[model samples]
Target: MKNKLLLLMCILVFTTGCKKDFLVQEPLASFSDQDFWTSEASVRAFAMGYYKERFPGFGVNDVGGVFSIRETLNDDYASVSLPGFPSQPTVSGGGWATYFSDIRKDNIFVDRVSGMGMKLGDSATYKHWVGIARFFRAMDYCDFVFDYGDVPYYNRPLTDYDTALFRPRDPATFVLDKVLEDYTYAAQNVKLDDPGTGPRGLVITRDVVDAFMSRQLLYAGTKLKYDPATSAADRVKAGVYLQAAKDAAARLISSGRYAVADNYQKLCSTIDIGATPAVNKEMILYRRYNTGEVTHAIASGNNVNTIQGNGAPKDLVDAYLCTNGMPIKTTAGVNPAYLGDQTAANQLANRDPRLTNTFRTDRFYLQYIETGYSVTGYKCYKFLDEPTQNEAYAVQSFNITDAPIIRFGEVLLNYIEAAAELADMGTYTVVQSDLDKTINVLRKRAGYTAASRLPDMKIIGNLPAVGATVYDDADRDPSVPSLIWEIRRERRLELVYEGFRENDLKRWRKINYYNTQLYPKKNLGAWITKSSVTKALILADINGNVTSPSNTATGSGYLKVSQTFRNATSGFVVDRNYLLCVPTYQIDFYGRNGSTLTQNPGW
Candidate 1:
């Protein structure tokens, strides 16, 4: 009887094709709304997926691509293929496509939850989930709009097979409107404080929504092409949105929910990976990388002393201000403190303490097999996980550090910059006051004694002799409105290697200014000189005595008897071609059915 029963069950399973369906399931396939998003756990899981898509790693894997491209602007690493030529490189469409894919999933979640009548516990919880989804959707759209100019906007799951599958690009303004709409919804629905008492960084809080709205409004107000096509009133609308962003930031700052970390180095190393949330007050929205998951080491390698060449560029090293909140070049002749023979200890002397914490200068060392590992140029130390973690693999070396997507400090800077720009346009003149507040806070937290006093131009006399010409007003006192330039200089320094330079340059319309062949040519000399080794010691006998020789091996291993390493400079100037061309592959794939897309000019 048992044998007969088992035979019958096997037959039924075979008829159902259960084993085949289970074995051949497509990896990319997702469940229907009916199968997913029926419970609060499922909703939380959906939120996790969105975070995962946005922050793929703590280090250099898929997440590294997003971070690396942004740092490309100010000098972290030069494009090897382009040599010394500054060019705009398109982020391969993978990030954009992945973001859209996640947005589609988020939309599906929203639709499912709205229809399922599943108890999301309470009205606040339900609205919060919806708000979170919308926030991510807005963020994803913002990324698309910033990079590609215009993209199709999808708010909900597709129902019409034909139209849904073949939607065309909307106007850039239309896309911005959609982003604003979603952010407005999120800001309205989400609570400034957590209702469910979830971990501060786990779910989208009211502060996160506000930060997103602030950033969106600032971008909309700044990008000229996205400004409304109406009359002069459009300019007023831009200012209004910018002012709103400032107000949001102001409210958050007043709430005292966040503060700058006490030690700048502690902020990057300890705060990034330390037990207990490191300074959550400043972090408006951060994606947490658990012990064994994502890490920063993968994105920017910590294996700098080895064959891995993941150090940051001289431009970034040069950006750090000396003790008195002045650019290093304002003090150190063009030689800059952190490069070449300047030992890490001396290079980091009297500089922004954050530089030492955020980057691996020649002075910092990692524990290697027997001896310590050290390198020349600084390696990005922010977001890197300590080697002790299980996630630090032999092959991958992924540092599992949580990545901050949005923070109060950034919001403060945005508010200050927006306010300053508006003040420039005759809206207000307290711009210097706004800037001082933010800079003072960061400097104080960095533990430098000089934070209490601004640098006196008379004390320093003229600017440091080297690279002074790069500053247009080299002769002008470092105070005045020319000090506003210093604000940007401070932003570049304070936020070095954090992946903001490229976008900042783009918005300022300063891409042409820095993208020229001349700056890169002048900059390449520092990079090549600093990267080359000066001497090597060899074991001479069984005794501990060693013989030393001046090594003249070039990076290519060719003997360099006389010639100094020189990088080729592109003589051509940057023009409209400086903007990246949307990848040709994307156009070809989507151009069917009257979906032709325009490429950036001069590609």
Candidate 2:
């Protein structure tokens, strides 16, 4: 009966949804049969399923996909109840339990298919399946450490999970080392590209592995290199990984196949990729969405029609460079001209094209706005496509845009940052050509000129060997070079709300980004004054209803999320918030009267 149940579950795991399929895999003959491993087609299909399940293409409302983090937590988006570091958070949804099925499926694939002979393909083709399986496992662990801190390491499927589940939490270093191991293997062995165009855009490839390794390595190396949480020994080892990150990125960059395409918008929220994948060459791996087949709600979440308002913050707005390639904050300020206009277009005027491309300006989509759903005046435009993203609508699925899961633009970012940060960590100096390869190239893509000659980074070496962090520098971060700051700023602008911001805040220890001290007093939106739209804005939901007119009704400035998160006393406790609270009950159960499941600190 137990084996029967396992067989049933295993079959279900491999059963790809005909509708949800991105790189659809045909089923093996009778999933429970041992002969499942005999066919090369079945093995390839199983590998494709890993891509589908691990980096899932989200729908309008799927956990771990579209609405995953409730974007309001980051500096970019605004929401009703501002988030605070929990004083006593309990029962953080242990990300592992939710992903155990996936890990098991991955393990089974790696274990079963690895030794079996492939009748239909050469050994090289067979290695690709192994690499794909390892990649998924590594990706799962990378995310695991990101959230829960330390979890037991499992390389093979745990058929008797009840007895084995209580294995003690491993140190984060051990888990990250394992992650590096898997990613390393995958990078070397994964197929250069998919077998053909049908799979080329979606299947796991060497470039995808390299890009992800660069990303994961960059994160792991940064956290170890700087964060006070890391031990001195770990800090010493940080360079090894940081250098590895640089190398991984360099391998892909040297290949020269990927480039920052002319249109950054095409890399996101495009229903166009399915029809013309060639145009989105910059996309190393993007989740495909067909109207009836696989779809996501990214459009609804960003566009006016479905109304997931999610206003982009003023600070974020200010991050966009002016047309002359200068920071907007340098020339623009919270004064009468810039802030008082109360019109979205005026607010965005003279800023970078990305600002216009990314945000919905003064043009009221319907005079209908909601306070709870978004930042008051502003709305996001990054993941939105016009004509199709409208209310008249594209399909019942509501979104058919192929979301870019990984892009070469990010790899360039990972490379440049790892090098810059490494330079700070040691004697290695980051020069202008480095900027040319990454940041400056990105600037050109955003349609900026060369006089943008980037600034040189300086090491703000004020951090103590061991203690609470303090900054003598103005920005309150480790005072690195002017160039490094610009690199950081560029990343913030380019990847705003694409799901990297929140993680950026955590790894860089920029928790203060969400804290109130950064803002003058409130989390201000674009400047607004009393006018027809002001009256409308006051009494407007997305449907243009006038129910309750509250918040900035005066002839004043921009919109705002409340002044809670930034306020020190607004229930956001520092240090304690760095990690989330794991449920005490689970800790207790997993502990099982012994010290196996150590909880995250301050939880």
Candidate 3:
């Protein structure tokens, strides 16, 4: 009884696959497929299972969910203990079988729900349940396409004796087209407000459907547009998908069903964001974690005692803009608001309020000098409830903080980025009004006063401008347009540590950012003074050898805890890193079944 509703819903997935004779011998406690699909409550409960299956709020117990940690291989963090990017491929077996097993479960739901016509009551309700099934099926397929370029599309569940499941991989574009169909149907048919047998924000609504559609479409559009292997016809499809992404986000913005009205910090750290109208307005879909039922320990990882060996790197810290809405590394002189990064206090001053909200800025909790609590010194307390740091529950695996699965803040960022990307492709024009409604609205929600609010982002003479003054970032990639660069900067700052940086890089064809040679700052942490640190501060040289700070420099420099010497040459293989290799055994299975499951390019 981890979660009553989730456990109830999961009964369909777990019990439906029993032998036909087993159903004939069903006990009083067991629910056969016929008994389960007859009621509306059962249908709703079945869909609820997907919430936990896919979302998994802060994860169960001590494990971190999507929002609480930055342990992924990305530019946002630097750690000596973390593994480097794969330089070569190996037979990583049994990935597709697992994915397809979960996918077939969704297929079973879809087939049964579609055939359950008139039994669950009305036609609209029937369509809604089917839409939920398709939404999850499409989401699962999208994940498959992301990892492996071409994945076998299974629209129906195959029996154990059927060899159809071992078919060749479908075209990536074809799979995405099918996904688009699913999302379109879900967005159109899902209820705008569905009060299920649970809390308000637990069930999937039209708004949630559109929110995820916006994200997935943006990812699809950008991945196709940037990938060198994409055909010219597919590039046109990229524009189409990008337009659809913009429209999906636009629908939510125009509907006004949600707003950026919650406390930025509390939205992710509170036990119940849906407790108040004002706070829950931003939350589109959140998993509520009751203290005794489905609690987790994400807070403990961010607590005072725990040391986040994998800490936010300088690369991520420098992405935050100054309060004046200008970059710290602008070609237009120097931003006076930036106070320099010699110390944590100086670095936190005059920066975006999110920087302070995301990192531990309080001097007592600042672990920059104390190497034990944080490796990079930039400790993230974004999901920590400060008052509960010392509570008995906080130290264990039961800290009950609700995790934001989808929120208005992310939708706004997605909207602006998609709109800006459309504008970049000459299909749309981004006006000042667009900025006012989206990016500027987010800035206002980030606690900016009326007078100190960031100036509206404008495209002036093809460069990104704060009002009328254009600013250029020296570190910007030459191929990326100035406006696109700024939009990406906003996205990175808004969504950092929320499990997006890695995927963002992949979709943009910029996975080479993980290379420490091209970007040495990826391995460096906070700047510090050696004399201030009481503990033994360790660092590595260019060759990854243990070394001390330069004695001549008086021990004041970046805390370079890790040096990726090997990755300087062999990191992030451009030929094969974007898409993962299909397991060799799975390909062999297809071959054995007289089908061709070709490996991805350069795998």
Q: After aligning candidate 2 to the native by TM-score, how far in Å is the CA of 89 from where it should be?
A: 3.8
Task: Indicate whether candidate 2 or candidate 3 has the larger TM-score.
Answer: 3
Clashes of each: 15, 18, 0
Per-model TM values vs. the true structure:
0.71, 0.80, 0.90
Worst 10 residues of 3 by lDDT: 363-372
Worst 10 residues of 1 by lDDT: 557-566
Per-residue accuracy of model 1 over 172-275 as CA lDDT, tens digit each: 56777777777777777877767454667556788878877777667666654222233465566567667767776777777778876554443333324335
TM-score: the better of candidates 1 and 3: 3
lDDT of 2 by residue, 1-603 (tens): 999999997776667444455345556533664677887777776666666655665534334463323454776765456665556656534555665666777788778778774663788777777887788888888777776676788788786645676678787788888888888888888888777424655777898899888998888777666578788778766776788789999998899887786666556766767466344767888787765576666666665544544465556676665444445333133322233235666667666566666767655332234432355566666776776654533433457777778888889899999988888887467765676688766656633333432222222342211123221223324455555666687787777667787778777776766775555322555554445445534432212232335543444444444534455566573755656666677777766655557777765
| Local distance difference test, candidate 1 | 0.54
Candidates 1 and 3: which is better by lDDT? 3
Best by TM-score: 3
Off by over 4 Å in 2: 1-33, 58-70, 84-88, 117-120, 161-164, 274-278, 304-308, 329-346, 361-374, 389-397, 446-481, 517-522, 531-554, 563-573, 593-595
What does candidate 2 score on TM? 0.80
